[model samples]
Target: MAYRQGVTELLRILASAVTALLVAAPSLAPAQSSQPVLEISGASFRPLPIAIAPPIAVGDEAAAADEIYEALTFDLQVSGLFEVVPRKAFLADPREPVGPEGIAWTRWSDVGAESLVKFEVTKGAQGPKASFKLYGIASQRLDLGSTLEGRRADARRIGHRFADELVKHFTKEPGAFSTRVAFVKRAKNSKEIWVADFDGRNAAPVTDRGGISLLPAWSPNGAELAFTFFKKSMEYPNGHPQLWKANLGNGRSSAFVGRGDLNSGASYSPDGSKVAFTLSTDGNPEIYVVNADGSGLKRITHSEGINASPSWSPDGKRIAFVSDRHGTPQIFVMDADGGNVERLTRQGNYNQTPAWSPRGDLIAFTARDERIVFDIFVVDVATKEVKRITQDQGQNEHPAWAPNGRMLMFSSDRGGKKSLWVSSADGNVQRKLGLADDGEYTDPAWGPFTK
Candidate 1:
């Protein structure tokens, strides 16, 4: 009931804040019905036949926009939602500053194309600007059009944004291919938290206090991070580990729970009203829920053994956690109010870091095999079906799901050093995150994008 009460209070606060802000600046309020709705059924209906022609050159600029067009086309194709017809395959190119002419719609229809994208490149004050237009094949009407201004080096990001907008026009859900990941970077002497765009660009260290920071978890809004840091001194070599929250936007941070002893593994509630963390201040490591402002602390579990890794369900109705209360670590689920506790895993000898999927269907955790090799596995909450997700190589652990629940990000030693790797929810298409100078990066946590 504490979690529920905390969430209720948070919702009330947010509602009041929004109301006050709206009242103070009515003009700043967003339009009630500005968002367009694209039915998910559209995905099953039919993928639009899209044709992307090379950008028309402007002035003396070279052919730099070709790479941007290719990247954008590839991004749309990977989403499993678009049918891109090659320009070479087409009888004629649908270049910009011109309309669909004698070109056979029959050819596109034969190729299963339902849409077309035509673009042109122009020289801008800053750099090259790309102008694109999307047209529905059947209606021969424009669906969306926009111009992106950026330097040649930033063409990739601009292309991703363009594709993302295109996906939103047809799918209703925001595309996450352009999002970034935040995680903790650890070394022998100290640990720091870092963040990078999804493609592993613009990675920078967030903490540089020289303490042993670990277990970085993102707030639902992606504006703040919760992590644990150990303060070392001559008298206490091991140091005292405490939980801290950092506001990424303004570089402001504060200690979340300063009771000291050992407070770590903090995860924010789905609504960002409360945080569930493990505290050993009471002798044994146990799970506790507290308000976002660090008030009204309530213990959730009182098992004899260690209980940690609390993850909230998407609807904020239940929490999935890991517990060794049954001797070895196993996945457990309980109501948000800390009632109706039940065990969810039975096959694995050891299971830890249970992450509840955002889709609210499966729970991912690290399971050790008979050979004591740890790998990632998912368990269906309803059917209790256990499926192993990781297959080869060294230990793979700390599986974190993307906001859309389409893929997972986890830490692995498969690349000779501990680095972040992403795979489909079923553990396919595994690829390294390609971070800069990978020096033992672990415990990756994906954050929701604000836009």
Candidate 2:
């Protein structure tokens, strides 16, 4: 009966298009319709054929142009929607196009490209200026267009914005380009929290607490981060980790919820008004909810065993967490006020670290099988259907959702070293963050879109 009620509610929301609908403000047309994209029901979604010409440089800025080109190509390809045509197949010299009027649509169409995108980067005294145009090959009608400005060192930033706009034109949802992913990186014997560009290009430490700093959770605005800091102190000689918050603006941090006892994971509500965390002052770890200002503390879970990893639903109506109350750690969902408790993972004997998607369609978590190997799994909230997102990949855990809900960032030891990896929700394509960097990463939390 509960499953039926949930399914009916989901269908009603789906019929009205109540959720997963993004405004078309970034779309260059300014009036793009609210049509849907390929559903994520494991449908054989078609990738649009799009040829992107190498970005042209104004006044001999080849490196800048190339960097911009790379960023754009990566963004579109990783999106899992657009099929980027090879630049080697571009029949028209990108530089030959003085403007959109000079595009050789026939040549692009000959190469099987359904659409084409062109961009020009100009380095000026004010910094760098970028202009782009998207056009349909056969129709010859401009699908979208936009201009952006940024510093020469901000090539990746500008490119991400451009890619997001392009995605908006096609999917109506903004791409994950403008977002940042906060992760924990290890150096020597110390673990520090670091924040980087979504694609893991510009990475820098957010904390230098020396001994260890883990469990980084970003504020909804991405301007602040809450983490657990551990260090040697007179009272805690062995080391103790207490919850702390850091301001990304000035890199300044202050104690957040230092209960002077064992405290664990923290997550912000969708509206950033409340925080759900696991505390164990009563000798039994239980999930608790508190105001963002650290007030109105209340307990959400009364499980006798360990209860941790509270992931709040995007609507802030539910919380998905891990509990071993039934003798085995499993994924469970409960209301924000801790009512109508329901078990979500039935088959798996061990499932933990559940991260609810931003779109609220699925909850991704790590599950251990009979072999004692860990992998990622996603469960549909309405249908109670379970799908494996990772398998046999060397110990995949901690699946965090990008702000757009189109991609997931998780930690894995597939390459002999622990690092953060990104993939679509269905686990179709997986890649290492930063491509070549050899940094040990964990506890990745994707921040909100650009401020």
Candidate 3:
């Protein structure tokens, strides 16, 4: 039941920790909308210039409005889709009316603001009610608007919700702003699972078991996480790394695959019905799949060399994994039933930790180059073209795709101490996620959008 062979070395290869924050859900209400949607093409992409006026607050909601403004501004800055004009550049009043008719379009246009945003927050019986409006400067028309009622403690969520709507209005798809990223927070003698907001806000631990935990994976529903846990406790004096599932709602964890000699690299299917992971039950590490509750165990890879890090395709019809059978660790893919296996990455001799994108077009992975430095890369699933994401970044690894597939989060020591970093998939925009300076974090798993 415990991994007595190669477990210690494996632990060193996949070490990580965690932090998280939680808030109550808020109700949504659709406001006014009229739009000549913005069309953005990658070949000729330019960040949209937008001005966000200071949020107006009524009654005792100043603090809530400020929180919402901070969160919303951060979300847009990192989105890679907009250039948020600075407040210092503002020619218009910060306390502008939310209605389109009362707006001074000429002043905003003078500052080169293609679009403008205005919001107001009022104290509500339930909490804080935030109303948002987006204006197209050229058209001088209201493009999109929404009102979200959230708890005062969750004013940040209200901001995130409006940001998501802003993204959807232009891209026709929801933004990943409302999602969370789960990472392993490493301390002196402990490694725990932590979930932070997509922007790395309000990070706190979700796991407290005294053990080595790594490679956290989010369930499709964003309600649970499956990670590898190794602990030497009363039941098992010998520490073993096995897959464990943690419920985000109640902070409860249970063994999902405790029978194997080693269980790691848990990946949930798109439907959340089953999980694909690495198991070493037969002495050789290989990919395996089982029901979410740890039933119906089935081996997915039968290889002499190590096979691990199974990532499920968005359609739940295929899996991307790592294998060393071809003489070097490389990315590989196979059908959901473990048939039709094919190699994915042919460029790197030491490529591993493949994470299938939600769009199913690219698989982000970690590769060691001739310089012996590890960095993140993504391979086009259809064309087999490999694109390096992190260059000369300090030991970047464990690439986890954002829910929208437009961006990804990876662990890097570039800022020192192995913190989480997010990057636009094209490697054009990158930012270090704001995490604590004292702790080491790794193995980021970006969660799906919350329901």
Candidate 4:
């Protein structure tokens, strides 16, 4: 689609406050600790200042331990919750103070650190074991402790699990680090579905079909994905797009809806028992739903122009979709049973791709403002109050919400290259994820929380 374009500018932004290590001033004493100031109130959030000590090399595999060290550091940093103390300023050795009780709490206070995480990762015969010790600077006490065990190849997953724990301890909400993102990556001459870690690591192709793929949607169970795929040939010289589903675990891809003259935007229902998609078998695109098995087909919208991108509400009571029934693309909400239709987004004439947050509190979508720039915006489903997320930051589209509703990942051309960026759900603490390759990524879909 022409709507998909390369980003014209580069801009990196995050609203969460995180600062590096700072030595305590002369006025401070070893017994004194920093006050707890990190809290989330409404749309505003304050990043906490925290320090981490390197894990001691456990065996002859000290070099191997480096992977865990780097992965852990990257997870916490991208979390946008803490200002990590630089390694050069790390006053404490990873070997000493193995236990919190044997440590000098004043050292962190002296370095102006408010919170701390001291961990030891060891590769053993069984697997890798990471011992994490959490602390509060205000009291110089151990707040929590846990052990994570994973296979050697699971080093990154281990780090993500540990980072999420820290975020949970401080924010009272689960972190999004453990999740993954699925998107369309441009390869050679075609685009295909690809999935990567929350930090954009381990990116690999999910489909080998040499064609154009877009708008991936993960099933609520995270076991399958549905997306729009187009393969041009004599049968489809002009490109006939169809909706297809893939078994993410087994690498199976098959069309679920192609009878329509044009099929795209396949969104699974909250219950995972049915799917809502846009089908244009009648020469006019309209919203439709069918059983998970592709049976019990039912049309949800009747319009002359277009109605696509059907996003279901969390409760399964309603669906927020895009339609041009009013002359311009705008967001609309209708009952799950197809009744009581009402327009939800009133401000923008060019609004589309409405993604309802898992928490059911907000709906994020893309809109082209009067300035003729595409940006991301979120509307409170209850109050209908709209909030702008990305303004003048290259074309930002495809806002996908993390399962916890704490973060959102979208595709942007912030640096003149179309790549995925993750940000706090409220547009705070944004960071561009560096995927494995330089390939442009688009239409990211944040998957559900993994077990």
Relative to the true structure, how large is the alpha-carbon lDDT of every model?
0.77, 0.82, 0.86, 0.80
Q: State the lDDT of candidate 4 residue by residue for 1-451, as single tens digits.
A: 3333322221111211211112222111222223343586555766677887777656654554566667777767656667777777867755665465566777777787887777776766667787777777666556667788777777777778888877776767888887888999996888999998888887878988887888999998999999888856697996789888999889999987886678888888888999999888878988999998788989988767898899999999999999898899999999987799988888978999899999998999999999888899999988999999887689898899988887888889978989999887667567888685568999999998768
lDDT of 2 by residue, 121-169 (tens): 7876657788888776665656677888778788888888999888887
How far residue 182's Cα lies from its native spot in candidate 4, in Å, is 1.0
Task: Report the lDDT tens digits of candidate 1 across residue range 152-203.
Answer: 7766677778888887777767777677788878766778898887656568
TM-score of each: 0.77, 0.88, 0.87, 0.86
TM-score of 2: 0.88
True lDDT of residue 450, candidate 1: 71
- Using TM-score as the measure, name the better of candidate 1 and candidate 3: 3
- lDDT tens digits by residue: candidate 3, 260-347: 5788889999999999988887789988899998999999888799999999999999999999998999999999999999997888
Candidate 3 minimal-lDDT segment of 10 residues: 18-27
> Worst ten-residue run, lDDT, model 4?
12-21
Best by lDDT: 3
For candidate 1, list the clashing residue pairs, or say none: 1-337, 48-114, 49-113, 49-114, 49-115
Alpha-carbon runs more than 4 Å astray in model 3: 1-34, 40-42, 99-102, 233-238
lDDT of 4 at 127: 77
Clashing pairs in 3: 17-184, 17-185, 18-184, 18-185, 18-193, 18-194, 19-194, 19-195, 19-204, 20-204
Model 2, position 451, has a per-residue lDDT of 58
